[model samples]
Target: MSSVGDLGKVKRVETDVVKCKSCGGTMVFDPATQSLKCEHCGNTEVLSRDTNVLERDILEGFEKAARFDRGEQASFKCSNCGAVVMLGADESAAVCPFCSTPIIVKEEYFGGLKPQVILPFKFSADAASDFAKRWAKRRLFAPRKFKKTLSPENMHGVYEPAFTFDSKTRSTYRGRVGDRHTRVVGSGKNRHTETYIVYRNVSGTFDKFFDDVLVANNSNFDQKKLSSLLPFALNEQCVYEKKFLSGYMSEVYQKDVKDGWTDAKKIIDANLYSAIKSTLHCDVVDYLDISTEHSDVKYKYILLPVYFSNYRYNKKDYNLMINGSNGKTSGKTPISPWRVLFAVLIGVALLALFIYLYSFAE
Candidate 1:
């Protein structure tokens, strides 16, 4: 949890206001129309979709210190949850998506790098909450009340930071590969087929192009749960526009570009290995060594939309994430202890019945 002293040092940055052309009321991005909608006048302003989203040179990014904060935000420290989040300057007080604690906006945390592209939300909070309820219904061990009482008010739309790396790789690899084969080594009564691996030295040059391999840069959320929200329509991303961020909050990238590259390289290496193995067409690889040279490496800092909700059950917090682009949901829910106990009792009864049958047979 954040200390009162820590919160005292925080300051708020003024945000640019987007007003409705008709009523002059505050306007927010409406996902359904892909435009800015006025809360008071019910008017909508269409944002241009002519996005020229570009990838920056990876080597160039390495030459500079990578920053995560974009200066257009106000910082808030959640005293109850210890979550430091950036909210739009206009948003004075908001709830922490991680622990559902109210946070008071204060200072600017850091002047971070601006995202190159954004995938805006396609669904509303009510839709995301409905998806969550339907998803909860599918869990056999979930409590019934959880499904009945899950509310849309608990879910909020937030933008998550990620890095998408594109690269053209050339690799030279050498390895010993083996193919399994069987042969009869004995005759007559002693005849038996023995399996042997036929090994051969292999060397090859492999080239592959990797596009938009995404790696999340946030440490606050569950990595596996975040991954389950994938297959985002990343191709439909738009150039960074403040209009898109009217009402939503975004996470500052915690992993720097260099560290992000390291993660991207790990993904590339695995893909390279698969490509090399496919070229060799070997049943088993004994040992493989590869040296890769990457050229035309490009990366883009991107924001993906998600509807986030956190719930606490049995003194533990569970997170639910809905893909803002497609409404696909993933989350952790509370398990019913009574259901688990009943399952254990039934298992014991089955075991006892099997033992009684075995005794009669004996």
Candidate 2:
């Protein structure tokens, strides 16, 4: 609830360095043990898996949400891809995880709402790379060399930004729906079955409470790709802590709270339409107009784990995104034109043979 000017006076950046009690070495959050492990010595420290996540009221967030530009931490922006990333305090130089461009420690001011909760990475970078490799192998059209040339060492762990909203909605809808019916239309040889639609006017009131409608806050991470990596185990999210961000780069959110809520509403409206249609139990829908009122709206700004790898084949570049919490992967891969041509030829040959056999039978 602090204003940007009020909080900007404190210029101390929050550091992610958690020193080991046994050894003086730096410790990082290790997914293998779900704890902080010392890099020098093999000492592990358990972190409290706090599940008491808070959702701020939409009105309150608009007025008094904490802004990151208050100077609590510094971020680095990539000149090549325009990605803003936050790094550990001790780190001075890092490569842009998205584009593999070398970036220096540039203390740039980032203005946005600080994350309220974080879903730490559940797997290591090596595991994410393995997931990407398996996913690429399943691409039927992908070139063979592209699959074999995938480098796991290029994988980078990043905490992607997102917004999840909860809302109670009441909707009044009016529409006309139709159901199909088959009937005998004629007599003898002319008698044939014809399909007709029975239309009826329907109107109803629907009341529903939607929880955890997530919208991606980064422009580079599109909604389609984010949806493909669904079921992020949001129940396991922990309260935002600097320690959770250790050993990983967190992307600054590109979309604001207002824009994020707008996107969330679109998702909610689609869902509402489907629910209403299902309740009507109609085969086809002619028209439906729904007027919805959203109340008691709440939202949470959170971060999710993702691994990205950019690979170049020939003169073009292909990218892969792996879900750090789960093993789900989505990305583009180079396709083999020769393989596609061979499949087309086989299809044509099969069709010609089938026609020749039918003519011979006649």
Candidate 3:
């Protein structure tokens, strides 16, 4: 790691490269051992784990946030797809995992907020691939040929960027809700049953505290993709250190802090709406309007471990993601048309048989 001299005299250039003491070879972070392992000599070095992860005040914003100096860190820009990837200190060149374009390392600074905390990968790449394969086999509609031919070599580990927000919210809501009531009307042969809703106005105040509401800060890795790999163990996050990024590529967050907070508020509002609706205890909701105020807002810029891979079948590409922290897998798969048609035919046959039996009984 590069050391900082006098701030007034020299600019700080940080570089983190772990080397094995015995063989003098580059050592990368090993997920299996949660330590630095020399690739050439198989020597392992323990990493000092820091549990003091702190959250930053949203009001302070990015102006006071620390940034990396571009002159020393290695980065590469893909000309084909316009992806900027940051490499580990020991790497000089790599293939673009997004587009398969060859990238030569360049020493240019990519400015973005440094991560405050990171959920380091808990499993190795081979384990992630196995999890993906198991998930694919469980997809009943997936094509057999596609499943058989799925390749794990395409998988790549990436430290996807995201922002986790914490806030206390107070909401005042007004809504009309209804309960269904069934009644028998008329007499004799003209008697019939009618269903009606009893609607009433409702207003209430709700207070709640949200912790670690995660919002993806990279455009390429959107919220939908992130949500599919749900339930990350955010409590396991450690203080951010460049050593954790060894042997993996990290993405720079394109979305800024303010924008990230805006996204987080949306998620919070959605949860608040659900909670408020549940409290009403109505059979139906005509309409609901809620006004909320967020207070004591805090945010942490964090990096999540994820494995990205894609499979192409019949000229269509299906993307796959595996949670590196856990073995959970999520992805798109091509459906077998024949299997779908067979299922639909069986469903129709069952429905027809049920109707025939009912008519016969009548």
Q: How close is every model to the real structure, measured as TM-score?
A: 0.80, 0.80, 0.80
The prediction achieving the highest TM-score against the true structure is 1
Task: Compose the digit string of candidate 3's lDDT tens values, residues 79-128.
Answer: 55665555544333344557544333333444546678989999887787
Error of 1 at 355 (Å): 11
Q: Which residue ranges in model 2 land beyond 4 Å of their true spot?
A: 1-16, 65-111, 341-362
What is the Cα-based lDDT of residue 3 in candidate 2? 17
In order, what lDDT does every prediction score?
Answer: 0.76, 0.77, 0.77
Taking the tens digit of each residue's C-alpha lDDT, what string does model 1 give over 267-293? 789888988898887899999999999
State each candidate's clash count.
6, 0, 1
lDDT of 1 at 329: 83
RMSD of each: 5.5, 7.1, 7.7
Model 3 scores a TM of 0.80
- State in Å the error of residue 283, model 2: 1.9
Off by over 4 Å in 1: 1-7, 66-112, 185-191, 221-225, 341-362
